[model samples]
Target chain A: MMVTLNDARRVIAAAETKAQEIGQPSNIAVVDAGGNLVAFARMDKAWMGSIDIAINKAFTARAFDISTEKLGELSQPGGQFFGILASNHGRVMIFAGGVPLRKGDEIVGAIGVSGGMKDQDIALAEAGARAF
Target chain B: MMVTLNDARRVIAAAETKAQEIGQPSNIAVVDAGGNLVAFARMDKAWMGSIDIAINKAFTARAFDISTEKLGELSQPGGQFFGILASNHGRVMIFAGGVPLRKGDEIVGAIGVSGGMKDQDIALAEAGARAF
Candidate 1:
């Protein structure tokens, strides 16, 4: 089953709480199983440029059903998925902060966060996923 | 000041209420004064294709400080702004369902609605703008 809007809200709330705990304002986004945006939030004073990044990160996570962190590893220079960012109308975000949401063994959706260092963003995203 | 995430939520809520009253599942988006998306929601069973359209409609409204319906009229053949859609990386949506949010005389943001007929979209957008 796809993630519902209520599920997305909970995910976003958890991510926001994590960002606050880390003192990092963030842009958070959720995308459904179909890779369509379900909900998004830009915390006050978050980097404006990160809005697109956050949303695309979620899309990338669900697009391949893999964490964007792993995708980043695979898309490194000379790696198998290198240049993959050139596809999906440039919406493939290859980096941390994108995590797939799972229900039992199936991926239901994804959460993406931006506006912090890689580790911080990843932490926030993981926190969000845990709430799902 | 630009629109905040809280403001975007209120706007989306109003638009969603209007959509429900009219029996239309809609994609709703809100953009701040900088034309950056503040928040977005895709109602259950909403047209997937309209997700992009809804977001861009809000962007187009804020980008030009004009309702997309007005922009559509201007972008028509033989109009002063004909062919303007070719610009903005195809983010310009020249159609109904986009309304600017105003504070006093200043434009602060915009709301966009999709997943319905032109008139219905406009009505929903107007409902959102009214709430702002």
Candidate 2:
């Protein structure tokens, strides 16, 4: 099954809560199995430029079925996935804060967060993914 | 007000139901005010190529704040937007099935439907936009 409206809203709420606890405004995005966006939220005072980054993070996660951090490692210098970021019309994100949401064993969707440090973004994203 | 995840999902669901009633599996896409994808659904057996078409349609609608059908009319030979099809990296769609979602007097987002005839696509897309 897909990530319904209920699930996406729950994840966005969870992410927002985490961002609030951390005192950092954030942009959150959710995309389906096909890497299509389902929902997004830009918190008050969040970095406007990070909105696209958050969306791309979620798309990258769903496109590759891997977290952005893991993709970063794989895309390091001389790594197999190096230069892969140029694909998909330059929409691939290789930083952090993107995670696939699973239903049992199948990947149903993904969550991405931005407008904070890498670790901070991942923390919020992880919290959101848990709501899936 | 932005089209939240809840809003996008409701639109998609409405579009899906309309497509089902017409016996046509469709690819549906929703984009936020900035023309970024918010959610997408590709019904089982929907035409794969239509996925991108649906997405571009939504983007185009949001970009111009006009229905694709209207855009198409204006894009005919000797019309004002005749050459607009080659703009935005060729992502513009000039056809039916794309409509802006409005909140009060504001254009909040847009919905696009593909995988059916132009009339069917427009009908489903209209049903979706009304959900916003």
Candidate 3:
């Protein structure tokens, strides 16, 4: 089954709560298994630039079936997965704050958060994923 | 004033019902005022390639604050807005299946439908926009 609207809302709500707790306004995006957006929210005071970044992060996580932080590590200089950033119309976001939503062993969707420090974004993303 | 998750889901639900009535599986996309995806749905058996088309249609409608069919007419050869497809990285979808979602005089978002004939897509898109 695909990621339903209910699942997307749950993830967004959790992410919003986490971002509020961190005192960092954020842009949150959720995408289905096909890397298509399911839900998105731009919190008050969030960076407009982070809107695309958040969506791309979710798309990248769903496309690769891996956390973006892990992708970033593998995409570092001299790494095996390097240069993948140039692919997919340069939409592969190799950064923190993106994680797959698992149903059993299957990745049903992904959530991405932006407009904060890497660690803060990761925290909000993790909160969102945990809600799923 | 933004199109919330509730609004997007309601629109998608209405669009899905209309597509079902027409016996056509469809890909639906909803985007906020910033022309960023807020939600999307791909009905079972919908054409995978139509996913991007659905999204671009919504983005185009939101970006220009006009129905895609009107834009299509205006963009025809020798028309006032001809050759506009070469712009926006070819993401501008001038077709008959995209309409803006309005809140009073404000254009809050847009909905797009694809994976069917032009008329069917337009019907579903109109159904979605009316749900808002």
Please report the candidate that would top lDDT against the real structure.
Answer: 1
For model 3, how does the per-residue alpha-carbon lDDT over A30-125 read when each residue is reduced to its tens digit?
888888876677776678788789989999999999999999999999999999989999789999989999999999889999989999999999
Q: By descending TM-score, how would the candidates be arranged?
A: 1, 3, 2
lDDT of 3 at B15: 97
Docking tier of model 1: it is high
Worst 10 residues of 3 chain B by lDDT: B36-45
Q: Choose 2 or 3, whichever is better by lDDT.
A: 3
- Per-residue CA lDDT of candidate 1, range B1-132, in tens? 479888999999999999999999999999999888999998888998999999999999989999999999998999999999899998999999999999999998999899999999999999999988
Ranking of candidates on DockQ, top first: 1, 3, 2
- Candidates 1 and 3 compared: the better one by lDDT is 1
- Is candidate 1 or 2 superior in lDDT? 1
Pairwise TM-score winner, candidates 2 and 3: 3
TM-score of each: 0.95, 0.71, 0.78
TM-score of the A chain in candidate 2: the value is: 0.98
lDDT of 1 by residue, A30-58 (tens): 99998889989999899999999999999
Order the numbered candidates by lDDT, best leading: 1, 3, 2
Superior candidate under TM-score, 1 versus 2: 1
Candidate 3 Cα errors over 4 Å, as ranges: A1-10, A20-25, A32-45, A78-82, A106-109, B1-10, B20-25, B43-45, B105-108
